[model samples]
Target: MKNRSVLVSGASIAGPTLAYWLSRYGFDVTVVERAPALRPGGQAVDFKGAVHRTVLERMGVYDEICRRSTGATDMVLVDAHGNERARISGDFTGGDVEILRGDLAAILYEAGAGHCAYRFGDSISTLRETEGGIEVEFENGPAGNFDLVFGADGIHSRVRRLAFGPDEHFVRHRGYYYAIAGEPPHREQSDGPRRRESYAHNDAGRLAVGSGAKAQQMYLFAAPEMHFTDEAEKRRVLTEKFTGMGWQVPEMLAELPVLDDFYLDALARVRMPSYVAGRVALVGDSAYGNTLAGFGTGLAVVGAYVLAGELAASEGEHIVAFARYDRIMRRYAKVGLGSSPGPFLAPKTTYGLWLRDRFLGSRWFGLMEKFAGDAKDDLDLSGYPAWEAR
Candidate 1:
């Protein structure tokens, strides 16, 4: 292999998965994460179709993932009176299997940690391409040069900013924002049966969902773009958007201040002509993210597999490998383009909400599910024998 040393930004799903494959293919891989440690328990993410299952099986984590899987939970849409108006099956939302984002990250991290170097609580400060390779400067650690770098750092990726351009040029806000707030760390669970159904209450442009135990809360609302400087701002924005809402919303908001795990971000999408620029390439959300579009995690895992396989197949010729990676990923990721789940989840008009409810209850919803499954399996995945033999 010509280019054996590589750096991957982000320790979440995509970065660690990429690190695992690259190291397995005999390349020296280093993963950099901004967080001090792996984040635990935010929201549930799922994998669908044969493509996702195949990649998991290849990585040898399929059995473990299944053991840790949180079987799909059905969602019920309810009115302020606490009457259920519509239901969305777990099969439709949760796909083949579902797991918490935190758990999946830990699984990928552990699988790669034995071979790949990990630097947490640090992030890339700068990137300069030299005649030999790319020189990278870190926020807290010493700088180093590497043969290649990848941005798997979500939509607002620091690596993307340094190598590509500003956020405005690539990330497009979809006029909606979503937030997830969980129970404080080590909180005791109430004595009762675990929540099997999640209830959603929507009012015009806002939606609030709460589990049976109220252990996790999710909110989605339509709004113009706004930049929040701190957690306080995010809390305030979330409160303002759903204050007048009914159902269990008031109680959910009341617990926000005490919650330790709180996340809020705009529903955005990434648009770029190519995933590669010189020696730097992007994967996962940094490449083709459409927030809550239901394909982000699946695309990220599959992209990592393809990228590492291509590099090993090409004998580490990044120019050839990156071009192939970009071409394949762009086509497979098209399903996530030009679509946003914001309006569907929290419609801006009463009629829109009614229409959504009707659609969910109609036969067409089945067809929609079939279409999604097909889109996920659209790729003709190449069997890179170099990695396969190992």
Candidate 2:
């Protein structure tokens, strides 16, 4: 096949997944990640509906993923007095199956590692399109030319910026921010009966949820667009936003400084007219990502499958394959653009919070769940028999 040498940016979900399929289809694949190693223990991500299941089964990682599954835990919403006001089923939030982001990444990496070259602690600094291929310069490694380059980096994707335009052109802040932090001391008790149920406490515009043992904590709050230069700054901002709140909020903030896995970012979405620019293309979040939208992981896995299948079917003609991938993915990825989870999780007004509680306690929430399931399955997945793994 022509254009068989491919470079995928990012070692997270999308990059490794694309690498797996491309290598399986007889392409030389290289994956570059900025982190020095595979990041461990991230917030849980889920895969729902038949489309996601089909891709996982095709990749032959379904059983293993199921083995590692973090069974869905119902989220109970409470007030300042720790009174339960409403409950959101795990079936609604966690999808069919939920697993830590790090675990999922590890699985995808292991499946593809045997056939792909993984370059950790490095990232692409520049991309130059040439007659023969795209010349890629790494932050800490030797430059190389690849027949095709893909950006699965993330919403702040370096490849997207270099190949497309700046972040302002595509990434739009969704008027909120989120943070994930874990207290290692309590992790041992994570599987305990109390920890099996997640609890959320909301005060006006802010929401704090913790696995009962305080092992993992997720905080969402409404905020204007802002930037933090370091983890200290992020921690400070989180403290400032969530301090003096009730129902374990004070305790969760107190553990923030000692938590090793603190992560904070804007709940943003990437909008683009296309996923391809000449020899360069983007997949996953770099293509269609809405932070915490609940469909990103599934979209990434499926997008990789389709991109690789198209390339193999077209005999590695990137122009033809890229266009086809873009068309199919854009349609399937629309689910990412439907709504932002911030306002839903952390409402800005007391009335909004009350309305959310009422909604969750009512029958309308069931209809909404059905709608989300339908959206997840709304794709005519094309099969590439010729590219099936031996």
Clashes of 2: 0
lDDT of 1 at 120: 94
Expressed as tens digits, the lDDT of each residue in 210-264 for candidate 1 is 8744478889999999988999999998998898889988888888787778899
Q: Could you list the CA RMSD of all candidates, in the order they appear? A: 2.6, 2.2
Each model's TM-score, in the order given? Answer: 0.96, 0.96
Q: State the lDDT of candidate 2 residue by residue for 1-390, as single tens digits.
A: 899898999999999999999999999999999999998888878899998998899889998887777777788998888889999898888888887788899999999899999999999999999998999999999999999999999989999999999999999999999998884222222452122578899988899988555487889999999978999999999999998999988888888787778889999999999999999999999999999999899999999999999998898998999989989988889987878998899999999998998999888899999999999899876576446853
**Worst 10 contiguous positions by lDDT, candidate 2:** 184-193
Q: What's the C-alpha lDDT at position 236 in model 2?
A: 98
Clashing pairs for model 1 are: none
Each model's lDDT comes to: 0.89, 0.89
Q: Where is model 1 poorest over a 10-residue stretch in terms of lDDT?
A: 184-193
How does model 1 score by TM-score?
0.96
